[model samples]
Target: MNKYLTLLLLAAVMISCSKPSDIIEQRTFTVSLDTVQVDSKDEILFLNYFLGVSTLDPSQKFLYNLNVRENILEKINLETLSLDTLIQLEREGPNGIGSPFKIIALENGGFVFSNNYTLRYMDANRQVTKQTTLTREPYITDLLPSGKSLSVQSNGISNDGRYLAGLYETSEMSDKPEGIVWFDLENNTGKLIQTQALDFIRENNLTLELEGQIRGGFSTAVFFEPSQDKILFSPTSRNMLMIYDLAADSLITKKYDSKLTSNEQKPGEAKTITDLNEFDKLREDLLKEVTFGEWELDSKTGYRWRFSKELDRTIGEDSLIFKTVVTAIDENFELLGEAQLPQDFVFPYSFWIRDGMPYVFLNIDDELAFVRLKPNFGND
Candidate 1:
């Protein structure tokens, strides 16, 4: 071989063998919070007193909240932070959706609402176009084990509104989810995917029983990655992630080793709490220990962001200080950086990423507000 050609081939081989860390430079980010207050225009915004089922529109121009108490859909303008409209929904009659608990806004000005058993797809005019009940589907029944059942509240529709993804709980009373169900809304078909990767959640769950009633357990955070056409399953008890590719129909698991905190939580043995105080203490302690938060994907940067919390300290009385860390991972699931947020940072009830930045839901007094975390990624 020619000397120049041989040298070029060797260089190519070296580049191909390079790790993600070698190709992508590690970057640090400083997060600054900007609070935006909502303008309700003299009308009271029913926030449900907590983080309820809400979603930002595809264009990020509007936010929709399902007022479970009033059976109304509250549409707020994101750019203006003003309450734009409130569409009343029927509780009975032909268009009744029956107390929707989950909602998803479609790109084509429609919405999908999920109750306990039925999923109703409604048009922009608030007219029910189609309805599906998981309990009536024979395919879902066969997919579950003898005692397990489908959890409609845990399900979410795809961005294109073509499919729905959810998990199968071990039982109606159990907090542990055992399998994933991918259902096609258009074709009325479904497939159940199970893997040993989810065993950690089943085995490591901290369950406390009192008078035959179970309490104190963790649940997996499910995120639908519309850009990649995948569903990500992140268990709160561990630093592991499972990605289900919709197109390829494959499940892949990735485990992370964190330098900022513990990789996974080690819960004490489950026991019967006889006293209410004992149960409360144990629950608080479990939350104080390291636990993962929500997982968000930044489409602009192709970087996955994961939030985690650990007990920083305890103030006087019942006050607890937490150390929240945000971890950044690449497209290949490689950890690139971890940033510790300020001690005064308020934990978000819910969050979403728009244009590669995170916007967390905040409640200022009785008004709706949002704290946008502007990130500066650099070497410093």
Candidate 2:
């Protein structure tokens, strides 16, 4: 009788080990884009179509690429929208354009974007045609932009393509709110824009809610502006849209949180997951957890875990991007929507945007993508 009981236990253990696996689900999104007819003249739609996210300029569009592997700017096309090994600088001296803050196609055949230290542009030959100096006066994290230290976040080119206008990064830690900065880019033979957010604000005089709860949170995807020329930004954690008008030199702060169905979505449409090593590590960790037993999905937390689970899968650090939806808006800064986020997804690391179109780049650590209006946007 004892042997029979032991044999039955062994049979049960073998059956459990060979049990079919439960489905590990991914967040599915039936996303839409206000897609236009891709210009036949453009050959590299999938190749050179990454729109650099600038708060001010869209026509200031230029083509550039990130080495991605090294977490550095690999090639910037200063000229004919091509690639080169040279580092593009935005400012004085031959500084390398590491962080590709923005990039666009220039009419005369070139591209430009901001690195950590400069506003670099390239000409047709893909050479360092221009480099505007950046004021790295007070270099610290959290972007402490004082008066002397020009903080450039976004910029815009004029309709006639004669001038470039946009927000210059600044902080009036001394004065009122340390508003936005405006600068000139056409003859930008210098480093930073010598404009003020107050100048633009007074022109349009658009009022924005400067102080809000949960000040700075993860960009979760991409924060979008109308064009690179408009210094407009949206709140991922809050419910507001910050628009800095270059002509007005003012920030027209619009609150999306105002009675709208605002969903926290991956900011951009889609981005390439660049880091391979990091992704592999995540897979291994997840597999280890899966080996323990069958996990259950809990909606309240959006996680499949046992009471003994201690691994914290922070989105930007561990998982992918956080996606949401911007459904509708009303009068006040009260947002309304069913926010849909990935299980264990926390936030985003970087951001990107497209030129001309209303698309934004939603970049997680390894995952990256663009967010745009559905092709049939407003159709429904």
Candidate 3:
């Protein structure tokens, strides 16, 4: 071969073998917000008591909520920014959904609500159609005293409504089964699989102590990915994501670094409430109303809803602290990258994600604010 051609071929081979550092894009999204005003009655009705939000259709035009303190399911027309009644639930009697915790509307006009350990399906006429019981059997072996019972929280139902998943606490750590289960809605059965993520955490000799227990708190967010056939549970106090893959029948854990924009001075560390009594006294002294929030997700990404523990000195008011956080992962639940909320985000908000975009609902000075974070990928 000619010398020039030989050198050129060698250069080409080297170029092909060399790895490029720019594989995944690492970009930060800037937040843009639009505010809307609500009527005086609607504003008064939902003050300091927004449960959670979901959309009726894929268009996400109408957002719905089951009130935190009332047996009422409300809907907000996003286009008009108005709130109206969807249903008024009975809290007692045979037809009652007792002390309801969560409500999910089905496409067929039927609805599902969870009342502690019971899940009831209500027809369009507000009649109880079918019911299912969640038990600790097979998951919990050590029988506790009569009053003591296992802890179970209904997490998320799949988009297709095939599976319902939740977090279950066992009596002891020796059981070794993962503390999460998926209930097959069609078969009316529950199966608990040991996820690989908890195993990885143990294998790596990592410590995840939070709230006086090892991985103690229920994740504020639990997501079911029908596309990937995986369930993701994100604990509020930990820096870990637990994924249960249904197709592979395995559990995987992914951990991310500290990247959230919390108003707390320390982002990831646990805050000490030295005197519980004093804290309660202060709350009574300084606060009129307080609302505890939960998390929801449709697919891979979702919103984490929280309320300010105390008034933000800079913001100068106690507002609902809702923000957006997205996790990018392969089908195997391996973490690729994630993006944090903008640090300077306004407060008193709620949010839901649709079509890779976050729709933030905020209440500032009795007005509703809608914020969105559009993607602008920057290759690295």
Candidate 4:
């Protein structure tokens, strides 16, 4: 009887170890362009550094980007494709913004940005509405007072526009918990909402470069539900989604069963850098030759991760060209779509979902272009 029980256990384990065949319905999105050309008269030299995009209105017809060039915040209208300089930051003064770091778009068409660790909120007119100093609160384990040393990698505003979420990594490079904070924009109070212990580093087989982990690979993208008091997020490295219930203060992880590999190449082709070892190899080779760009994505659609490689054939002296790859996965983490973007395509693309479909915004040389994904195209 014991032998039979052991056999049954072994069979169950084997079945669990087998690859899952079921996947979300595979679909192809048709790509197109709704071009928006920026005029030189606008004084915006380039759309080279993209901060973020926000609709600011429920209509979703208009999009705005708070872009930066040498510390100036320029608001670009996506609907009209017009540029307006709202604020020119200074080094020291009341309105002095000391080297702006990141921008957070609000629901009401306004935005927030960090200048030297101070959170500043701006109105639609690009005027400073409020400012708050980042502080430490006790909700997460081993909570450290981040002060000005907190490195905010990615941030998002809740759909309700009440909470601002900031994902933090300290510059100290010690083995500590990875945490995110939610600040009540109204009350000027914040709490450390989520944290993951470092013990999982071994369990997940995270590759550590030098003394610390490669944070860019594990940075989490925070997204809020349109109507619910919940947040959905995914780490950059793996095919997993985590939902945080704000009201209950509970977390739920959804790991999709997938057979798809994270390869930009077509099926069965040798991947350039499929896993961590290959990634390390690429890093070593490109240590002095390349710098990665931003990772931008839309809700439900996938994301585009980019990099600029310094070419051996110089356009002049040390000229750089960009390359980007777009990847789309469904809620189940199944590969729904992908595209190896053209070299002429722009950096820091924008994505949004309208009417249950995903759309991407790109700047093609002189014209801004939009690409929308369509459904399945004949099973391959």
Q: Which candidate achieves the best TM-score against the true structure? A: 1
C-alpha root-mean-square deviation, each candidate: 9.0, 19.2, 12.0, 12.7
Quick one: RMSD of model 3?
Answer: 12.0
Going through the candidates in order, what is the number of backbone clashes in each? 0, 88, 4, 3
lDDT of 4 by residue, 1-380 (tens): 00110000000012233357744433345433333354435364434544242333344444444444455555554455455444455445655445555455566666666653466766766567777665532332234354423334445555445566655555533334366555665665556664672123212222335334444333223333212465555543334456676778887875433222231111121122236676565444333332223323343334322222222233565565544444445444344444444555553334555433344555556444455443332343
| Per-residue accuracy of model 3 over 1-380 as CA lDDT, tens digit each | 00110000000012242467534333232333333454434445443443343434445565666655676666667666577555677878767877655566676676777755777777778898877665544332232223333344325665445566664444433232244656666565555554433322111112234456654321123333322366766543335556667778776666544343332121222222345554454334323221122333434444332222222233435454444344443344443344433445433334565554455555566554455444332331
Q: Which residue segments of model 1 deviate by more than 4 Å? A: 1-25, 151-156, 172-178, 204-229, 246-250, 267-278, 299-301, 378-380
TM-score computed on alpha carbons, candidate 4: 0.56
Q: Rate the local accuracy (lDDT) of all candidates.
A: 0.68, 0.33, 0.46, 0.44
TM-scores of all predicted structures: 0.81, 0.39, 0.60, 0.56
Looking at model 4, the pairs that clash are 29-374, 30-374, 302-328
* lDDT digits (tens) for residues 28-86 of candidate 1: 44556677788988877777745467877878788888777777778899777799998
Model with the higher lDDT, candidate 3 or 4: 3
Clashing pairs in 3: 195-251, 196-251, 197-253, 320-348
> Lowest summed-lDDT stretch of 10 residues in model 2?
1-10
CA displacement after TM-score superposition, residue 179 of candidate 1 (Å): 3.4
Question: How displaced is residue 244 in candidate 3, in Å?
Answer: 2.5
